[model samples]
Target: MGEVEHVVGMDIGGTKMLAVVFDDQFKPVGRFRKKSKAKVPPEQHINNIIQGALDDAGVQKIRGVGMGSPGPLDPDTGVIIDTPNLGWKDFPLAGIVQDHFGVPAVVDNDVNMGTYGEWCFGEVQDCRNVLGMFPGTGVGGGIIIDGKLYHGASGSAGEVGHMTLEVDGPFCGCGKNGCLEGLASRIAIAKEVVALAARGDAPYILENCGTDLSKIRSGMLSRAIAAGDTQVERVVRHAAFYVGVGVANLINVLSPEAVVLGGGLVEAMEDLYLDEVTRAVNDHAMPFLRKNVRIVPAKLGDDAVAMGAARLIHDKLAS
Candidate 1:
């Protein structure tokens, strides 16, 4: 009865920004991705990125916009209290986009959106409670309770990456000792993998990436492990073990129905992470609490946050 409308969804992170255009049926028609830079202002970057997607889709107008960004932000007011990674503080992200595009916009934490995307369109089935862990440039997490994203009083409820695993472990970016992010993030894994490369324990990484943390991305590490780098495998397994420890703690506390693993690290080395994390959860969690809890890889990959953002805004505006 009415003309079909399209919408844009975006995921802005420390490393990259991705925008996807979705049609009435929520199918992607166009997408664009760009490496993130601290020098670039969010307003400039989002404008270019969203325009890129619109251009690719050959669409002139969109109904609304949705975005996911690194948090300490307010969903109700659309104010970003702070994003250490992006060097943005007290930024009004949703409002900026709304004004720029002349349409309503919704924003949420990137991890929460990613996990919510999984719940809406990924492998999670018939599950009301879920725990999502993503190990990337840094580790992040999200929680689902009774089929809804749980945003505690401060909208930082699902910050599982800050959970301390060891009192005297490596220093985390969060200025803490032995937070899980310091032990399990891609940055942390690269730190140890570099040392191994120097010692010739990981010849593949040494020759391929040359201890260059910037070049040692998740896909590269996975390739190195596949190239007979047993030491690299060991390092990744160690990180997975720590992640498992965190997951174990959550399992004990929340008794979630499913635990979803996503992000660049999990996307590249799904089998390895699954094997180690599953082992750790089994070893540490209570038998009763861990029962019937499915641990699975996220099916959405890079599009999770974007899709979730799109869906969230669509629902929000409809209601």
Candidate 2:
């Protein structure tokens, strides 16, 4: 691993898997993408993805591999304890990658890697402590304390979406009621939008997305709003408001140097999310705690987790 030439960062999400190759300096050289389908053979899929990226980069080998996957997981052991969306339980993801690829591999939570990716390479790099919240298929959160990713007792500490905002608000994918994710995730927003479309309250969504939650995506939602779908816009804003509430609670508890927002929802409707989240943070957060905590959209977009993974394995092997 001395004088490393390159490393591969793999991001495994509920719906997609991406492999990115980066040179020693952390510049992305090449990447590959595939659908994450459990029915397919995972070993072959992983092999194909890594090989494809290596081919794209024209590299015969890599020093190490770093992976980011949905949690709750054991980062130390590289085991995914559970991922409700992916239907994996107690899976030894890191071992499989290390053994199959013939290189050292490290695994961590996907959102944690996204935050670390941004903290290391994006706009918030200067901050000593940072909070990352992403609202997508589901809400995900990450925390960095004193320039390091913070893992709580279970290595799953930064689950801000699980915070109960209401006692009986709505059902969440995590099987909880009134969680912020239940009210504010892209999935939640889509569900409401679908209902609105079904009722003819959202003509754009009705005509385009057609009451199908899965068919409704972040960009489409934005387009619907721009097409004069006021109800759809309202649903998105309401979701943003709840996200801000969760952010306010975290601000009071952690007082992170910065609050960075990422994921599809923020990327698409950034203005609405920024305005609503800012307003809610101002109203709900302690005035002193909220002061100077810059909240902004993530710059890295889709590559954050992959780049973060590359940086992590590079540093880890170097150490």
Candidate 3:
């Protein structure tokens, strides 16, 4: 019997972690998911998830491991420079993973990995240039140029969320005012929805998610939208429009063939969000670029980062 050549891809986010085992062909053989518990050190949770996935897959020999984590991080050195959500600073993530598993490991920004995953295996694989904009707790972005991922000089190039959308906008988590994330992210929308509900304007949100702002989530917003809550629809539309505007700016600057939108909010309210975003792009982008660029939803869903991480390992081994 021959040993199977396998690899592991892990996506580490602010709230959760998912580790997947893949065969040489990049097919998922097994997966494990766990809460990240940001207050706690990440090492134990990461180890448990990877080992659990490997155990479930019944694999012993892994060629490599790739991880997608929040940034700003150094992809080349595999160091997490800083991640506010995860409270990690200057952490040698790749080295720790490699030492723990006795295999080569690579780490990059989570959004970058998701973008790469879509570029390699999702709808935009055929395109030479693409942009991935994901709006979750915060907005994250990734760029693919000339069929390869582009990490700017500091490996933080695709920070679409941090781009200033308004000089006097609300403060963002990144300590910036009027950034796209502050205006368009799910968190931003949730904040608006909660405020409206507190003001007795959004009875549906109040009824479903209660008065606690933290209780309001994307699913609640989706349900409220489906139930004909005008307030939810209005807030979502406003956010989606900003997202589209951001996309339009990217199109004008990068001239990408496609812009992929992903994240919980977009996945939940695809048609409503996409329509508004498309309208914004058409309204704001240069006429020629608008006509040529396609705005699409992400196909890979939660597995996008994992698939991208796997691809990263595969590419490294090949090179």
Q: Enumerate residue pairs that collide in model 3.
A: none
Best by TM-score: 3
Q: After superposition, how far is residue 309 of candidate 3 from its true place, in Å?
A: 0.5
Give lDDT tens digits, candidate 2, residues 1-319. Answer: 3554899998998889999999977888999998888466776787789889999998888999999998989989999998877888888888888988799999999999999999999899889999999998788999999988999998889898899999989998778799999999888899899889989999999998688889899999999999999999988999999999999999999999899999999999899999999999999999999999999889998899999998889889989
TM-score of each: 0.94, 0.96, 0.96
lDDT values, one for every candidate: 0.91, 0.91, 0.89
lDDT tens readout by residue for model 1, 1-319: 4564899999998879999999988899999899888356768788889999999998888889999999899988888999887888999989888888898998999999999999888888589999999988888999999988999998778889899899999999889999999999999999999999999999999999897888989999999999999999999999999999999999999999999998889999999999999999999999999989999999987799999999888888788
Model 1: worst 10 consecutive residues (lDDT sum): 36-45
TM-score of 3: 0.96
Better of 1 and 3 by lDDT: 1
Off by over 4 Å in 2: 1-3, 38-40
Per-residue lDDT value at 199 in model 1: 94
lDDT for position 64 in model 3: 92
Arranged by TM-score, best first: 3, 2, 1
